[model samples]
Target: MTYWQMRLALLRHPISAALAAVNQSGLFVVAIMGTALPAVFFLILLNFGILLDATQPSPSRLPILLHLILLQLLLIGLMRDAILGSKARLLLISVPGHQADHKVSMLLATLVNPLLWPPLFILLSTSPTNWPLMGAQWLLPVLLLGIQWSGLFAPAPSLVYLSLIFLLSLLPLSQPMATWLLSEQGMITLLLMLLLCQKLPIRTLFNRLQRLLSHLPLPVSSYIAQSVIRQELHGLVLRLTLALMIVAAGHLVQTQVAQFSGEVQTLTVSLLAVIAASWQLPLNRFLSAKREFLLSLPQSKICRATLLGQPLLLGLLLFQFWLHHGEHCWLQIGLLIMQISLIQIVTIRAERQFVLASLISTCAAMVLFVTLAN
Candidate 1:
């Protein structure tokens, strides 16, 4: 096959396509830049401080190297989705070709990915002396990256293997003592661990573990619903998690910091609104496909269960803050309620206008509430 056709075919694979899409949309670009820029900038400033102190040179270099390696590990590990990998493998199987050719094509397709290079460059630039050694070190990350890609397209058994290896690697990394010891072996050990974790067998293990867990005696319907909710609320979960962490940290500064309280509430409410608004378009498509299913259900049940569940999720978030602070901020609660209500109402009445109206109303409400509360 021609090069463009091969590239297109790889992209069509589930795992590769998602990665490519994530890379193309500049989400990965933004995330990497967001992470790397501040890190590098701050490291530069810190390096100057270390330069003035000649006594602790080794400590500084070691910590800097360790930190950079950790950052790369975090970025790659978190962003590698097994679902995407499975999808890619399916496409590979369907294509008529020599298996080796497909593997080579898949490898080359990864080269076009913006995600791979930026972090590699970051790693290289951060430790130029380590560059020559990185070929050896890179064996792990490259292997893991490739294995993750392979696992996506591989069979269930293969996914199980990959997952098991990942878990085993992670188990050691989790212990404080192990982590410190591993770091002492320096960049080479870290790179090897990364590569070993990336192998196809590891991914297969992971897939198998997931399948086992999924078959557990849980309420299948409820579990399915929750899975949907979690998938849809992924972005909101990250925002909430970060906001809660910040608010918890701020508690140390002052028990009754009005500034922290207001900032936390406003941010929490705004993020929920953004998340609710985002669901509008997707929900429309979902509802269109399942019009009959939705229609068969009682309006009251739908309103109470599905519709109210959306707001209640936001409410629970606000309630969490209230419980922590021990303050009945009616105004904050009202803003959150209104934000959720406004999004739902706009979504039902004018699906097309939901995005713009959601933004305008949420911003306006936040501004007014913050103004009056302060």
Candidate 2:
């Protein structure tokens, strides 16, 4: 097929169509923000940079570079799903042409993408010192852009090979030799060379990764239940756990900073109560499902069973908390239990309305609490 024909085929694919829609909307917003905000920020940064430089040591530049590298790694990690999507591979393999022709065609197709140029501009603008390594730096963007385009059409076999190369690249090498080579020619050249070697290998690697994910012998319903419970409980448990741990660690800091005994006690008790309440949140869905199933049987009343389950779940949660933390703060715990029961009733009446109202109220309450607590 001709290059244009291959491009046309890519556009017709389902994944491409969905991605195009998302890209169109994203590009419009991004373009607007990119134009308006950067100018304002650059002017602010120019003034701030002078003041910051006067106060901060020159050695701070290393930390700034490290932060930039970490941020880039995070961004690249987030984009992995978009890179690995099935549509990407279809586009890569669709061109019935030579390797160089495929590479060039894919590169051209990528350049047409609105997402490609902005990052290239940002990379060039931010690290002008590295511009002396222009030949190597240019290759990084080109290779990345090409890889992104090819990944959409890369076969399953190619993905597997790519994964192996990625793993291999993580191994530690001779530090002095590596540093000498990287510093002399620049790290981008090394990155590009490594990427080029893995290009053909990725198709095989991806198939293995796909099979591994697909063949994992986990029940979907059980997994979903576990995930839901984890997500629901995470905010409460993680926050409370971390807060308590930090409080313990920073006891001396708190004392030195003027400790408020009443506030500390109240906040600690409130967090414990909140964590207790969170346990029943997942039980709402479980009880609701059970109620529905039981109502279909010969002798169960849905309303009675659901009402009974609420108290039973609440009691169980209270007992669990009591066992862990003891019965010292019963009043606040009782209030939390009542609040959770009420939430469950409201949730059953109209979940969407209840959830929206609860979220708004929770946010407002949190703001008020933080303001007052401080």
| CA lDDT scores, all candidates in order | 0.46, 0.41
lDDT of 2 by residue, 39-75 (tens): 6345324322421232433232222222222222322
Highest lDDT scorer:
1
Task: Give the TM-score of each candidate.
Answer: 0.48, 0.34
> Over the stretch 65-148, how does candidate 1's per-residue lDDT look in tens digits?
333333223232333343223335665555565356546545654564433554454555555775665443344346445544
* Candidate closest to the true structure, highest TM-score: 1
| lDDT: worst 10-residue window of model 1 | 70-79
- For candidate 1, the per-residue lDDT at 293 reads 63
For residue 27, model 2's alpha carbon misses the true position, in angstroms, by 16
